[model samples]
Target: MGRNGVDRDRYQASQSCSDRFQGAFGAPRAEREQQFSKFMEHLPLAVSIKDKSGRFLFANEFMKDLLAADDPVGKTLGELLPPEEASMMAVNDHQALTQGLLLIQNRVNDTYGDERIFETYKFPLPMPEKRTLLGSISVDITERKRAEQALALKQQQLEELNRSLEQRVQQAVDELRQKDRLLIQQSRQAAMGEMINNIAHQWRQPLNNIGLIIQNLQLQYEAGEMDSEQMATEVGKAMDVIAYMSRTIDDFRNFFHQDKERQPFVVNQMVSRSLDFVLPGLKNSGIDVECREEPNVSADGYPREYMQALLNILNNARDVLLERKVKQPLIRIAIFRENKRSVVTIHDNAGGISDDVLPKIFDPYFTTKEQGKGTGIGLYMSKTIIEKNIEGSLTARNVDGGVEFRIVV
Candidate 1:
């Protein structure tokens, strides 16, 4: 061999081939050497030989391209790569030789940004002159590794989904158990925050009115102007206000119930009911809401959750209006039949969402509001309610002056 590279050992390893074909196969040393070069150069493999110090002694065309090297002889792997990459390659090289079948996997992006995975078979090759070299033969294996990973991930996801399904089935009352339970739980939690704020706003006026009524009763009794009829009249008025507050509680509580079966309900009436829950808070923020509905428009689904989704959208609208502080904040709601499907559109003039963020608004746990001010799941739950629970489509778009969400069921 030339330059103390392969020498006597390699020639002897081909002795049987020489014996069989003699002159035709290996009689001429130059012809045998040329054949070896041609085979290695054309082989569809990353074939390379490196000295003990990792200096490249020989590299085939495939190996040269793989290393991004036009010429690799005399240069070490360290010289061919950046310091950190060289270090990583060195560690991987050592690990590959120690592995079963000397299999080494490399994950990196190609020049075109496509991801590639390479599995290399690495080992040591002893040569003449008491020298040992590192040898490796790597095929593409990118597609193979990707397919194996995809299959394994698919299997893992199925197992995880099955476990999650079993757990949800045991604890949830809803027939749909694709973590409908989790969505319901988190939805209720998010709604509870808005409910409390609305309660504080709506209760303020009634409580203040009650306080004045009590003060008036004390004044009348002190002046000897209190009569049975007068006393009862004031008491009844107070009772009516207390009853209204109780009904509000009932409205909020009933929304949390899981529906057992598909039921028909007036779509407009449900929309008005949802408004009752959050209109107080919206009005307090000076955010006017206008709702228009066509007669006899109805839907067949979990109406309560549908209303909850409406509430979520309305609450989101209210928050946005309050945040942006538009001169004239308005939320418009319209319910009608479109393409024989019940359609509800809620729109608000809050200056609309940005292009970058509008697409991800319905994605779970995606919110632009400051921490503690917004639970990103608001719109996600709204989407889950319409698409999953109600078997419909929920979509949003930037309108002329605001964002409009359309729910079709």
Candidate 2:
């Protein structure tokens, strides 16, 4: 009973083991093959299998649709695609068969008239007869390629725009700097001309006095009435007049000197120096000048530039006074401290600026004077000097019976 029972149990166990092996190796293998074939047929990629001779052994539905072909099995790539595409695919197939496996990326036009890109993975499939089949799976990469290209183009455009913008900004800055330089140069020229005119006016009286003194000295010496003491006094007087003229030249030179750095300067000194430049002309024009100052009032700036600004204001005032020929013409300058800032006001009794012309007075090249008499750069340059160089403000307004120019530094 034991031996027969043992034999029967062994047979049953052997049969059960055999069935389990068949299920594990056969059933699942077939199921997986079926699943893979269905996946390849429906996948969103072109799948193909070709013999080493480039004859199509299999083609998935996607491949057939891509080529606009019906049945593709047993057909060559040359029969299913354009000559160019077929030749390219044949070369890849040959490479896969000879080189074991190959990867290729190419572009083509689909049957639907759309451009497409594909990355194909091609490998050899070993057959029972030692023949090789080329297996290929290619995904449509058209959208990805297009997106990458668009992004590259956009990046290039942005870079170009940035470059153009930088160039334009730099050009604008350069042009502005040039304009500033021109304005400064022209203003200096105008001030120099005025300085020369003042020098002439200042020299006139001294020259006339010297002529009178020399004539008298010659007359006395010829008449034998010249004494040593009288000669000494007369010479001393002539020397004093010459020294005065020399000092006047020095004052003019200093006023036009180029100041390279900012320094604290007394407001009254700056005013007096500027007035010294035009004093003779002011007196010649019968223009009475009055100045009042608050003690210790000082400003930190280029003194020459400040003096030039003051000269511009004073000259403008003098011009207005003479042009209008107002009775008892007068220019009044006052300097004081206001809100921790040095303030200067120059006003003249030349009938206030017309309301219509007031607002544009400070604009470059704007002037009420007739053409050729005024360059119109004086006030504009003055404002530029105060605001830009001195970090100050200059404003003008009609006060009492005249125009008043105010500078705050």
TM-score of each: 0.56, 0.62
Candidate 1 residue-wise lDDT, 107-162, digit = tens: 75555668777777888664456555567777888988779899999999999999
TM-score of model number 1: 0.56
Give a tens-digit lDDT track for model 2, residues 1-409: 2445434433433333344455655766556556555666678888776656676656679988877888766667788788988898788788888887798898877887888898989998664446555778888888898999999999999999999999999999899878877987889899999989998998999999999999999999999999999899899999999999999888877766788889999988989888888998999989999999998789899988999899999999999999989899999999999999999999999989888899988899998899899989899989999998899999999998999999999
90 Cα displacement, candidate 2 (Å): 27
Instruction: Count clashes in each candidate, considering only residues at least 3 apart in sequence or on different chains.
Output: 0, 0
Worst 10 residues of 1 by lDDT: 9-18
Number of the top-ranking candidate, with TM-score as the measure? 2
Model 2 TM-score, 2 decimals:
0.62
Candidate 1's C-alpha runs over 4 A off are 1-178
lDDT, candidate 2, at 292: 91
Clash count for candidate 1 is 0
Q: What would you estimate as the lDDT of candidate 2?
A: 0.84
Error of 1 at 128 (Å): 90
